[model samples]
Target: MSPSQTLEDESHPSITAVNRRIQRLSLHLTPLPPFQPSPQLHMLECAKAANKLEVDKASLQCYMRGKNRELQEKVINFFESRPDLQTPVGIPMEEHRELCMRQIVALVRDAKIRPFRYVVDDPAKYFAITEAVGSIDVSLGIKVGVQFSLWGGSVLNLGTKKHRDKYFDGIDNVDYPGCFAMTELHHGSNVQGLQTTATFDPITDEFIIDTPNDGAIKWWIGNAAVHGKFATVFAKLILPTHDSKKVSDMGVHAFIVPIRHLKTHQTLPGIEIQDCGHKIGLNGVDNGALRFRSVRIPRDNLLNRFGDVSRDGKYTSSLPTINKRFAAMLGELVGGRVGLAYSSVGFLKISVTIAVRYSLLRQQFGPPQQPEVSILDYQSQQHKLMPMLASTYAFHFAAQYLVEKYSEMKKTHDEQLVADVHALSAGLKSYITSYTAKSLSTCREACGGHGYAAVNRFGSLRNDHDIFQTFEGDNTVLLQQVAADLLKQYKDKFQGGTLSVTWNYLRESMNTYLSQPNPITARWESTDHLRDPKFQLDAFRYRTSRLLQSVAARLRKHSKTLGSFGAWNRCLNHLLTLAESHIESVILARFIEAVQNCPDASSQAALKLVCDLYALDRIWNDIGTYRNVDYVAPNKAKAIHKLTEYLCFQVRNIAGELIDAFDIPESITRAPIAMQSEAYSQYTHHVGFQ
Candidate 1:
């Protein structure tokens, strides 16, 4: 056969089968009790198809939707096609967990879910795939995330070629289930204080890994209870001394340790694993606690990309400082934070879709002798949900930007780039997850009693996503890290003499504005001035710069009396505010850039409205910050309020269209109210009070 014909012949069957399956699943996955398309939904779909109101599904979805639309659709279709993957309302915890793990394994076996495995063409695709699966089932998403991003990721990123040669293929195929053993019973975010120890032994040329105290036990380890055979363990490495003992000052390192016997599926010698019991949500993940008692692993088990110990007990590393080495090691896993943030966005999108659609269809109070109006028509409902809808878009584009940065850093491994990625990821992760948690909760409340039902999916989304704010580094701690980085940037501008564009671009760009007389003064006269993207950018930049300056001054003043830590503690509230503003500015800038690059005029126009709402709402929320800096007069503050309400009203009309642009599948939405139904009486009588 000719080359082209041969390629076509190879591709035809798989493509045809996928299409056939999707076609078949669509019929099966349609809402039960039957649903009729609402007029608004019909118009939304028509507009999307015509590109008159497209929202760049690739950007929103964070996958190569253009190139991988088939894969994306197939993944969604596969889940909708499988009832086994769906959790029963009140099943036994163990049974629920078993099914969850099984479903996760099924996804791992699917070709569409394979993009989440390591070494994909694009890192964003990894995040995109996880988010898509998560939108349907939070349990499966967490289970797969634990297996792939956390466990497989630690091995792939931290371990050497020898480790990869032995483990990657098995991990990729799930022949060996693994857990990331980082958080301890006593220490979660404070990795440096973890009590687990790996002591080097010259005589045996091995590392003795131990959880000496109860506090040292690995806690919240997904896959460790019953499925995992191995773990990438993080422990303080104790260097062997000539005085017949090992000391722990050497620093922390990651090691490959066997936790369970593969053939028997039981705890290995010197290891004990116990289930973490049940949780409010994501119980399907089988989170477990692991304790090690002098487990022996070979010297080569150390993942020594940044540091290593010789057989003779000498410690060596290319990086001089423990902090630098630690930063580099953790930076390799920032992908986890990025993934969590995007997954939270998925939850946000799903929640808002259910809430808004329900609001439009389910009506409540209205005038006497008048038809009951949709709850969405009420301004209160708009205030509660519209801004959240805007934020979902902001996070979508911001996540894409972070994914692009992560992909670039993975290729280059530049030190400055790594630092910037760590800082930005830390900030964005905290911002996205924190906002998503609040947004999800708001969505639930907006939907009234019906949202509390397990079937609605919002309750589970809220419960499952709650962990996001606490894990992958606590949001509060991560925000502090962002503040610290900003403080460093402020110092670097004077001390280092040169700065990278990522952290320092604002510094350079603001010089012109900072030098002008009354640079932040907002003229409240014209709509063109108020809504101009440039004006919005300037307002945000001014707010962030002023906050940073004020915090720096406070810190410096306090440091004279208190120690550095005490000084920082004294000004922490201000510092946190500065960090929050800085993160908001970063998101706004990235969202604007994405909007500018959009090729379609209609999409741009619609997206610009969402983008404007995001910016204005943030500014309106921080009016006190603007007032403190004299950036806006009282009249301008009122103008900001009026503009925000007006923007929300404009965006509200296209809210359904915007949700459609997210391309959420009805099967995943899992809420009947979100789907259109001609039997309004039936819905009002039955599902209304659930």
Candidate 2:
């Protein structure tokens, strides 16, 4: 549901029905939590669908607002018929993406999920949700897991019926969500305090899953309440006849427990669920809580990689340490974080689309003869939006680049390099989302009060996408991960202030820079960067490296005097800043590299502007970095004000052209608040009526 629908419009019975349908919606938002970021399309669908269906609030359960029985059926049937993709193979990711675009477009056209957007709430059962959120789960979970697994995850071939059939039986064809409920209300980061226990009964040959206390309740599980058919519940396995009635070194096990009955829409005995109350954003999702009272399962329910129980209900495992087993379980969630980063790129594209379109059309004062120029003509607007535009472009390329690298690493099983890639991606993901939260809001505000007007898309986008900042592994946590990686590099070079590797890197860097940035000539093959490629390359690399080194050094110094936890917390801010430095450096590398690769001159010119916009944007933010590198003297940053003005002028000329690349359908994009074309057309129509 969206704020646009006039809840006050109850004169008609239909409008009254619509308002009630929305009142039932309950969920939450992010940005302040340890979740993850997501795609732009999710936000766009909400805005467009709210306009299309004419609803109230940002409710994901649009089925609640169906006007007629037929419309409701259309909405429900659309999802019911969709296929589930268990393993993503043979299908091209691009094809999968196109399918999502077409599916949503068709969903809107057919009035399926008529209110729309709410359909994105569940990721397990349907293909689109699977493609979007499930894909992230895999991307992020796999990425993080790969890292965590190396530190500890069990080797289980995933997404295959072979392994799934063993553990995920009986619940087949249920066509609903499954959850991994590991977080207990009493213990978030601490795994030991989880009070849920599974006691073995040798006579019955069953393991009972029960939440012993209120503190043991599973909280914050996505799609848990209404959507989930089964859950992989984590509980301590209590073995009898043997010793301590208390916790053991190797008792926790992941069980495939069925919580909902098939014939009736009632909860099975011993299972309790509650929908989480309203949230700050992500209102479409049915985040929930669950409690188990004497819930029992067969011996096979335990995922036996680390620990298992026999048919006689005897506990048995060769697992070395419970710590390793616990690490393995937690390792499985790393892909979620990676996917959050990737999704952040997708959302960035939406911001760019809106900002660029508005920039092109929302003009004023720049051309007095024109009376009103597009807001993009103003340097302030460009400063606020264009760099972000460049950032989205940067992220788009970076995402593709990393995906390709990830795929390769997976193929080659190059563990060492993959770790570096994971670190880089983690840093990149953390950095991008942190900035994206700010950038998206800035772009939203650049639209003036129209930005706040829900009709224009920003407010809802802001509300729904709130989790990007701190989700999928907290931004701070991931930044520390990056800091840890950087500190390793710093320590490796401990004696290397001695300079052998430094000169080797500096020489290779020079060679690549010189080769990439050939002389800036009018020759057809000679690109602008070719003119003085080294200077441009050095501008990004030297400054970023300098900043990263400085922060890492500061952080490294405290380790000697302070306790580990204290130092980690003390250097938290430094880690975050260094994450930004990596982002700046990576984006710079991506932008300069991509611009040079474009074959067409016009394409090259447009791309070059994006690159410069990115560089200048960062330079403006940390002028000190540039100052330190001598890329610009202290006063030169002020002089570079001319560049922003000039770029704004240039960007204005190209804004319309660039935004067209997003390819948002005119059917969806026809509103004036978006492009102003709709309002203009309305004015024309009113004049005709007069």
Candidate 3:
């Protein structure tokens, strides 16, 4: 054969086979199926799921509203009726401040909602009105809080009857807008370290208030920028000894200082007031920095509840030491933390409601040739929002319990009760506000691009709530306070000292969990086992107990080397976890109690479902801790994860009714996407697309 003919005949068999296979595959290939047309089901499935259960929204609303429903309704209605009180979408900072002031003025003058009158007599009623206003407009809520809760509360709680008689009516009527000046530029969490000085002048019977330096300037004094005429200023009390040259420091005390002219609203002499200017949120609050230069006030201006100063420059207090007196003073002011925790639930309710409602209405991808399903139907979306929805309910009950305890504390003035309420308020305030601050962004993202629009309220809500974590007390520092109390109680438990109701769990958990040997075969993975309230509570209680024991040991072990402060710093993260675990247990306990106390079966069932989700979700999130300690076996942990998703689905079915139980008015929610009907149309109108 010729060379060319032999080459063609001897071609690679692999290449020939690949070419043949390609041709065969090409011959078998066909065009893809045509894209299916979108179906038009008119959201019937969403409506069906929304109305799946007999949620009894009214009964649930009444239950969630807690006490003073009539008063809360009145406050909500008053603002809802007034169009001017409705926060506009876009406005200048000065205008927003003016609007917030006007809203508060109307609330006091026109609506006649006087929280000051009920501050002591009916604290639940007081909190109801403040919380309601907060749900309406956060700026107005905070302005109301500053004027009534902080400034007015300081007078009522820290001062004697004479102070109330002088300032109560003025504050209630907005005749004298006031600021609570406790936080200095450099001293926010440490009131004991405040640099401002109030030196007694026995000859004049006056207190000369002086800011020692710029760091001593009172910063973030709400209402001081323009509206406030007076301030409840906290400063160190100094008493002059017999010798003209010697002065004694008497710790911190509150004094009423005039910051501005009451009639002309001019900055008072010796008081330099500068506006904090525009802020990320709460521009409506007129926050200002105040510098006092030897400002003189009558000796009577001293809020003499915890301590008193004689005209002869002598200091007297029933509490023996400065620390005890300070503790008592701060205990009385615990209402601020209580109110923050309470109002945070309101903000969470609004944000969750908006996110849930929008999720129900917003449809995305679905199976071909079928109507697009609501985002809420997607497990991913449900995971993002359902847990938050569950937490809102959990925090609601916890806040209500705190309010009741605080009210009882005020009435009884029992030392133990006061201490319990103080610690409880701190933990809840820190936990709930921190959760809310983060959840607001989650809610914003859950709503997709629409949430970014200012009209949806998420941007403003997130910004306004951002300060909540730091203000009442910085969350980290507050959590440390809780852990310290825990450690104290833990030590006291061994000394035969009785534990308070809040810490009683420590005793039982230490006995039941720490003393018992670990059982290798206790991994119950059934749905009932996972959802059982008893099981959930035990898990929570166990985690807290173990953390308490371990952290205490860690601190003790490290103290020998690192010293006390260094050891504390080294164990700080563990302490925070311990505090948070304790708080979660408390929240779960409160939630279970609320569910058990519900009168309506349908509402009880609904709340129970949400409560289950809250508990399981918490456990699932911290499952690693449970597994590492062998508290939960792998199978049980898997069951918890599965049950959490199952509970989310169960809760998602009635997400609409659950949010409706919050009963946040459309006027308050103000987000067009949160509307019950024609949401798209309302959104279009809101965005000026019409």
Top candidate (lDDT): 3
TM-score of candidate 3 to 2 decimals: 0.92
Q: What ranking emerges by lDDT with the best candidate at the front?
A: 3, 1, 2
* Pairwise TM-score winner, candidates 2 and 3: 3
Model 2, backbone clash pairs (residues 3+ apart or across chains), number? 40
Q: Which is better, 2 or 3, measured by lDDT?
A: 3
Whole-model Cα lDDT per candidate? 0.79, 0.54, 0.89
| Candidate 2: tens digits of C-alpha lDDT, residues 159-244 | 22444544332222223335557778887655655778888777888888888889999987654655556677777777776555
Alpha carbon lDDT at 203, candidate 3: 93
lDDT of 1 by residue, 402-512 (tens): 888888888888878888888898899999999888888888889888778766778778888899998889998999999998878877776745565565555577565
Ranking by TM-score: 3, 1, 2
Question: Residue 114 CA error for candidate 2 (Å)?
Answer: 22
Each candidate structure's count of clashing pairs = 0, 40, 0
| Cα displacement (Å) at residue 441, model 1 | 1.4
